[model samples]
Target: MNAPKLRWVLFTAAVTFLIAVLLTSFFKEIRKVDTLAATLDKRMEELVGEERKTQKLKQDISYYSTPEGISRLATEQFNLVRSGDRIYKIEVTSQDNLQ
Candidate 1:
């Protein structure tokens, strides 16, 4: 019961199905790209955090390697007195120091 003019209808249906399949494949690729982008962003943030920690450690190392830092630590932390320097000790209780 098919007519000779039904070829056009079949061609249109085929084209529509191909376009639908192509659109679905394109969306899947987009989803994969989005997931990769999110993972990369997380990794970049982790790297930044590690870099910040590394920089802090480097600053700390630099500070400790200097003479002034060492001198300050020795003078403030330890009761060591150098030559030509006067040392004095004073103790104050919390209750008696109140103004």
Candidate 2:
């Protein structure tokens, strides 16, 4: 409890407190950066998925430009057939409708 000894002890305690404060702040900043990086990584994955879908749609559009692809789409969507194709029609009864 001498004056010189007391001064040295007080200085050491202050330095320790300052170091603790700086370390706490540094760790907090690092955690924030880690969280932001994770968020950015999730967004990048979503963008990659959208890019793949866009590429697939573009390929489909290109396929639709061809003559055979257009004919297939017309047959599927409009039920159109080529020349000399026969058509059959069926009548549905109320009992068959329930079944």
Candidate maximizing lDDT: 2
How accurate locally is residue 81 in candidate 2, as Cα lDDT from 0 to 100? 81
Which 10-residue span in candidate 1 carries the lowest summed lDDT? 90-99
- Put down candidate 1 lDDT per residue, 36-68, tens digits, no spaces: 999999999999999999999999789978997
RMSD of candidate 1 to true structure, Å: 5.0
The residue-by-residue lDDT of candidate 2 on 1-99, one tens digit each, is: 646788889999999999999999999999999999999999999999999999999998999899978988988899998888787889767975687
TM-score, one value per model: 0.63, 0.74
Q: Model 2 residue 84 lDDT?
A: 89
* Runs with alpha carbons beyond 4 Å of true place in candidate 1: 1-4, 71-99
The segments of candidate 2 whose C-alpha lies over 4 angstroms from its true place after superposition are 1-4, 84-99
What RMSD does each model have against the real structure?
5.0, 3.4
